[model samples]
Target: MKHFAYISLCLALCLLFAGCTRTRISSFRVETPEAPEVEGVHAYMEPHSATYRFSGSVTISPKETMAVSGSYVNYSSDSLMQQSRSFSANGYYEFGGSDVNASFDWFGKASVMLIGFGVGYDDGIYHHLKVGFNTSVVEAGVYLGLYHQYTTLEINGSTCDTWPCSERDNWGSMSETNTDFYTNLFYGLYASIIIDDFFMSYNLSIYNPSVSGGGESVSSPDIYSHYIKGGYRISKHWEVNAGLIMSFVDPDYRHFAANVGAAFYL
Candidate 1:
């Protein structure tokens, strides 16, 4: 009940925040003899063009606000046991970035998390565009990103227990696996800065609620996600990056990751 209330509140906030988002603002580019191109946080070259990069990251300490499996009390055996877990697998991502113009830059990232056994799997993508300005010490930008995550969950039995389990009554006499799939979309605002070989960026995203099963849609500001990162160039072709990424199942449920990765440029 508490979780449901929290989710309701968050959805309300998301709608409110989304209404405040401004349309993309256009600006004149700074003309130079040289055009700059970049891929992610690593490689930067002149005559800005399409940039390609490969990267790998590890998600550390992902908090599970909602359990992927189920559990219950078996009166037949007078025992308490857990069903199975489906969210223990590691998450991975593929990242890409490019300079759309002298004053505009765009970035894209795709991620996947799989737990096998047909238990759980998630695929997500994030895309952002920024208008930028530069100084001797830093390059700054105002950014907006759109993110979508598709998740599927499968659980076997234990339908009686509340939470961590699907809502159902089965008296432990009959049991079957249950599967559920859902999708979400989010919008974000961020500020990015680059200082020579080092860079730092952060974003705040709000959920964009939707209607399902003929239900009314919702609005929320409390429901949101966060991304923060820092990276440094090690060589002309290699770069190292680290960051924390956070997501929520609802206003009350969440997931978090501490990530470290490297980018190789073409």
Candidate 2:
């Protein structure tokens, strides 16, 4: 009986060792959980949205390289018209806008280049001072800001030589219409809509003179026409912009321009 007890104890020890070995082998054979596949598409397209941010963007566009169409005609207060049909190279300097702010909100855009310098009836320096707030067409807000402009046109020899009046008569009145530097205080309703890579904005601004100086000084008008602009984001911080600017006077003025520039946010 004692011998049988010893044999039984040995069999129990063997069974315990076999069970532990089987458990160890089961753990080792388990395959590592497959690693998740990361996607790059979402990463590339995310920056284009309103939520996508930019630090700043800067671009330099020279007008000398662009072919200018149309001519500039200078008219005297004395009822004389002179025309110059020469190609002009003009400079455009604009800073700060809704898009500029939006760009930096995500990343950033910075540009340091000569915008354009043209020899048209254009003001040597045409500036746009706009204060606006906007959301998706789904959201709209009102903003008020000053739109100031300093424009100078050198009397073209071809146009000025044919003046109907003497040099003195031409000089006095010609100076009035040739160069204009005025600032308009405008409060307006602005709205924007974003579709794909394009964005469009409409602003109906009431133009009033905040600082009336230089040029033909006249009391501000009661009302002015509305302006509309549309732009497309070509790259991270680069955009192609175009717009129509108009005003009412004895003779209404309408200007259409297309330009490429960089927008920067603060």
Candidate 3:
């Protein structure tokens, strides 16, 4: 749609004038470690069409990261288009980490989808809390919480999506698994701003994980991640979004990704 194009153009202009280095970093060697998931801002700006919502997304960081995630939500009331207080319960799952991560959330809001807040827990990994204010054209918020970190290693075999690949002569299967050696607790901060359908967010985490169990003690660097996203509501029941995610692992490593997603209301 025309609105989507305008949003996309705005994002492009922002990136172009950001004044960061233009060096082309190879995506294959970048590692995200315990990167956080992308948060949705459009969900806070408007009412849903129905009491149930389902959403899914795919993200690719060239050769570095590939992931899929899904979520479901159930509202307590039948009609949610009016300005009233309500409650909802939701579940989310993702297959991008060393192992799968899942969580359940309970949300309470006092607005016609214009201003809201929620608190939830993340399956022993994260404690979630967020609050936001929204108007017809702008939305802003902050999310901060605690999370547990794990020491993990991932290995992958040679693989290609198409047959008879020109990139390599040999075709092999790919498998990824991780072993957790220790765990540490860290604090995370997330801040976001949205204008119309375009949004931007930043995440920060800084902590040192002391060695526990059998792994040798090592110092870890701080993590910084951010993204710019744009979405369009095609109908009351459907919305589509696309964005870029960039995560820096401090010191010398970073991960860059592009994602596309859709949400359905029913």
Candidate 4:
């Protein structure tokens, strides 16, 4: 009951903050680089900006006995635009020294990341044209991270649960597709609220691709997956962020992770 209420409150705050944008602002970062006009590509980049980065996150998933991960994120705003980018990696290994560990530990260092570069437009809109990739010596693939934000919101949720989990077979297998590959390429809108250097960000994403035994195919409409991340700033260069990360897909994975990092000027 508390989880449900918290989610509702977060959504309300997001709606409230999203309406807090100014009709006419004095200035922004980055300039508009002219492009051939298109329907959904109406954004421009900002040049002068401040960039904040999170070093990495250590995550422990249910697949291996235990694993560790790291990530890098940069949030910046210039004279014309505000943009962000992130990259992450993880490695898992079995617990208790084992004689047959060599064959299994070989699958330790599997990772993926989103290299997102987008343009911020007027009226608090942005487009994320991102590049995603993963490689493990034998097999490798690439995909696009298509994301857009059209609103802002506030978030408040639980911080007590330390470890989250999914079903046994819900790692990343789709039931309605025939593709031998899997990746994260979600599209959605996000809302956030910032007050006195404290912020709450919530996002609702739609996974357009559903898979079966064969490959990826267009299927029925999915559910609204939720993500809420909030934190406090300790100084001009550092902040601590933590929250609940979950999904609403067939093979869903839920977990709690936090990051303590810094923001740098670029």
Best by TM-score: 3
lDDT string, candidate 3, 1-266, tens digits: 66456545644664677621111111111123434442434544344321334555666644443331212221111222212222121111112322233333333344643222222222225554555554455555555555554444333234332311333434454433454533334444444555544455555543333221111111334445565567776776676877776666544556666767776655
Preferred candidate (lDDT higher): 3 or 4:
3
Best by lDDT: 3
Give the whole-model CA lDDT for all candidates, comma-separated. 0.37, 0.29, 0.42, 0.29
Order of models, best lDDT first: 3, 1, 2, 4
Cα RMSD (angstroms) for every candidate in the order listed: 18.4, 38.0, 24.2, 25.9
Please give, for residues 1-266, the per-residue lDDT of candidate 4 as tens digits.
Answer: 66456545644664666621111111111111111000110011122222323232222223222233333332211211223334342322121111110000001111332233343332123234423322221112122232222222111111111112112212221121121222323455444455665666555544432221111121222333455666665666555655443433234323232222222212
Instruction: Quote each prediction's TM-score.
Output: 0.43, 0.33, 0.47, 0.32
The candidate 4 region of ten consecutive residues with least summed lDDT is 98-107
How high is the lDDT of residue 230 in model 3? Answer: 70
Instruction: Encode model 2's per-residue lDDT on 110-161: one tens digit a residue.
Output: 1211111111111111222222232233222343444433433232121222
lDDT of 1 at 238: 76
Superior by TM-score: candidate 2 or candidate 4: 2
Those runs of model 4 whose alpha carbons end farther than 4 Å from true positions after fitting are 1-55, 59-127, 130-185, 209-223, 250-266
Two-way lDDT contest, 2 vs 4, winner: 2
Instruction: Summarize candidate 1's per-residue lDDT along 97-209 as a digit string, tens digits.
Output: 21112112233222211010001111343444444443334433344444333332222221222222332323232222222333444344554466778878666655432
